[model samples]
Target: MNTRDAKEILLLYRGTTDDSDPQFCAALDYAKSDPELGQWLREQTKCYDTIRTKLRGIEPPLGLSEKIVRSRPIPFPRIWSRVLQLAAAIVISASVTVLLMKWSERRNHSVAGAQEILVTGEVLDMTCYIAYNLSGPDHAECARVCIRNGLPVGIKAQDGKVYLLSGEPGHSVNAELADYAAKTVTIKGRQSVRDGFAQLQVEEIRKL
Candidate 1:
């Protein structure tokens, strides 16, 4: 398979635990021989590791599981019990997949030989914009909340293309641009495109 194909499949990969899945195994093998894809996979794996670490640190409320069990109105038949167990497993899997997609934040890199360019567009809170086509004045407040809470931000150009926004190394542009969500703005930055993903490392931003 090609690098793009491998990347699309690997996005669902849940680290080494998914090693036994044939699709994931094939993607992993392709990634190994491709330097750029390998680097991306490593980054994605690191992001997943960070999420896992944070999840492990969370402590559920005491007696929560017991309370939930007790709150059940009636015990189910064996078949119903099996169905409920299967449902729960499906829910957990779906939740993990959503989390994986939502939190796969890319690190800002200083691209050598990248030239500065100016782009004018409406600021965007990427998650909702990408998932639901949510944008414009009505969605601005929600966009601000999402961006302030660490979701990635972008700018949708007049031609309808979106460029993800970033900041200097070790800094995130989310905080600085949260207030600008859905507003027309102009940004001066260095643009980098890899694997069809475009990111703008903002040097200056001003509302239009």
Candidate 2:
């Protein structure tokens, strides 16, 4: 084989290239007549010898061979049975672990879903203008109104006229109302609203 072909054969033998029966046979034939190819093959053989020598120097795990030899003779039937048993155990364990993880994730999600607070009363009152006179005030209704108006879930009316609300704590409602009138509200910030009659205005609301 030429240098390129010879190199390809060597690579294939070294597992760097895929195996091909025709290429392998052709390489063997070419090596007999080509001096350069013969030398390359010899070098590859030397590399393999070096690798084998290194591997031989590595100690096997303690008593592995001894234990294998000392173990009872494994008949075909018993060997197959043991293999099946091992496979079954592995499959069962993997399935159980996967099921447990799914169950745990579901349980955690359920608990988190349950713990999520629905904004109600004064908390809802401070985020938007509430014009509804609905008696059965619920989160669903609040969400609907807020979503429809692109308003924050900061306002709710238990009775009487709609009140402008905000989550700004310790801030006067009058100050917020003034800010709202100016249209100088910020769309992003943290604030707290203490209670009703205290007009707290949110200058901004931003998605978290």
- Whole-model Cα lDDT of every candidate shown, in order: 0.72, 0.38
TM-score of model 2 relative to the true fold? 0.26
RMSD of 1: 12.1
Off by over 4 Å in 2: 14-23, 64-208
lDDT score at residue 2, model 1, on the 0-100 scale: 96
User: On residues 1-208, what C-alpha lDDT tens digit does candidate 2 reach at each position?
Assistant: 4866664445335322323466576776677787866665655544334333443466769987557656964455656865685455435433432443233223211111122122223323122122222222333333333222222223332343332343333333332332122121223222232223322244443222
TM-scores for all candidates: the values are 0.52, 0.26
The alpha-carbon root-mean-square deviation between model 2 and the true structure, to one decimal in Å, is: 28.8
lDDT of 1 by residue, 1-208 (tens): 8987787677566678889988788889998899978877775665445434544566879987567668974466656865685455435533543553344344445576788889999998775666546689877776776666555789998888898888887788878898998899999999888546687889999888
Measured by TM-score, the strongest candidate is 1
Cα TM-score of candidate 1: 0.52
